[model samples]
Target: MENKDKTDWRFKVANREALIGCGLALLNFVWWFGFAYGMGSRPVEEYSYILGMPDWFFYSCVVGFLLITALVIFVVKVFFKEVPFEEEEELR
Candidate 1:
């Protein structure tokens, strides 16, 4: 008689995690690319003004946007989600 241990669900869980990571990374890449292009194309003279500050100040917002975007992706990967697998435990 042979005793077999079954643990085949991990593969699917890991694959799901990889897929989520890839999708999020791609989204971040697209967002940063768009921001860089938009900023690079904007004329210095046309910078948006806020409280009399030059429009380039708006680019600072882009930096914040990038940070927040990264944080959101990180949070999504870390918390708010779990791969569907046959196992009852979450992957580390």
Candidate 2:
């Protein structure tokens, strides 16, 4: 036998938002891991120094950081929706 409640789970918008956020988070993690690992594996002598750090560190840690920062800002501004979660009323 199946049981149902007044709140139909299928109509929830939060699930979709959560899924998109989790997907983006996973993508960001992969991006960081791949670049940082690729850069870290190279010999120290092969990379030129930037700000007293290896070129790989400079690009992977510093520049990649800036790119991700911009990406987050853009996504938050353009893609993220302002939705009232169902819990707002319950908390009061």
lDDT of each: 0.62, 0.71
lDDT of 2 by residue, 20-77 (tens): 6787777767767776688778786676788998777777778778877887788778
TM-score of each: 0.49, 0.65
**Residue range 39-66, candidate 1, lDDT tens digits:** 6467877666656754444444555477
- Give the runs in model 1 whose Cα sits over 4 Å from its true position: 1-7, 49-92
- RMSD, each candidate, Å? 7.5, 4.9
Candidate 1: residue 61 lDDT (0-100):
52
Clashes of each: 2, 0
Candidate 2 global lDDT: 0.71
